[model samples]
Target: MDFEQGSINISDDVLKEIAFRSFIEVLAPDEKDVKKLKKSIEIERTPDDNVIVYVRTVAPYGQSLVEFGKKIMKNISENIQRMTELQVSAVNVTITDVVEKIETTEEEE
Candidate 1:
């Protein structure tokens, strides 16, 4: 979707892309694993020009709703400055859910 005509236009694809990029940048993965982690996140635009980003993140043993929300806000702010010509009032992130970590062991060949 296009958020260029004075209204926030977004689709699932766009939200996923934004969430993936934002998460990767803020979380700083050891490697680029967009496919593995992207599906666990969701993002939406609020009516007041704020962005709502939700994620089921891993690494610190538990999810940090506050930290994640801050990251998303920063990302959205930066993006608005770099990509858009409109004035962004603010970015509000809401962590609707959390995911539990499960141990994964890789088998040696």
Candidate 2:
């Protein structure tokens, strides 16, 4: 009896896609109707195949910046490693902007 192991190789674009999906899932889950705030993201790799992902995102104002940052890092690193089965060296998250949550102005009857 013979058994074979299969492997999957993803391109750089795939890496970017995965990183974006992961970020949006954790960070921008509520931004479905609205376009994704993350304008740019990338997955960098070392010569030895180590993975490093960078994400630039927008955050809602009046939130805990420290906690938010931690969540982004964890989500990106874990999601990528979980989905791709690759050793993620690190996940660097950058908050490019903070948009104030607009209050709904309903007219009084």
Highest-scoring model, lDDT: 2
Q: Write the per-residue lDDT of candidate 2 for residues 1-109, one digit (tens) a residue.
A: 1227765677778777777777667665454422443346777898878799887666678988778878878887887788877788988877766668522112100
Write candidate 1's Cα lDDT for 1-109 as tens digits: 3555766654546655755676667756545354556656655556664555565554334656677667767885576545544344555554433435322112100
Error of 2 at 80 (Å): 0.9
Deviation (Å) of 77 in candidate 2? 0.9
Q: Considering summed lDDT, which 10 consecutive residues are worst modelled in model 2?
A: 100-109
> After superposing candidate 2, which stretches have Cα over 4 Å from the reference?
1-7, 29-39, 102-109
TM-score, one value per model: 0.47, 0.73
Top TM-score hit: 2
Where does candidate 1 have its weakest 10-residue lDDT segment? 100-109
List the pairs of residues colliding in candidate 2. none
TM-score of 1: 0.47
User: How well does candidate 1 score on lDDT at residue 31?
Assistant: 54
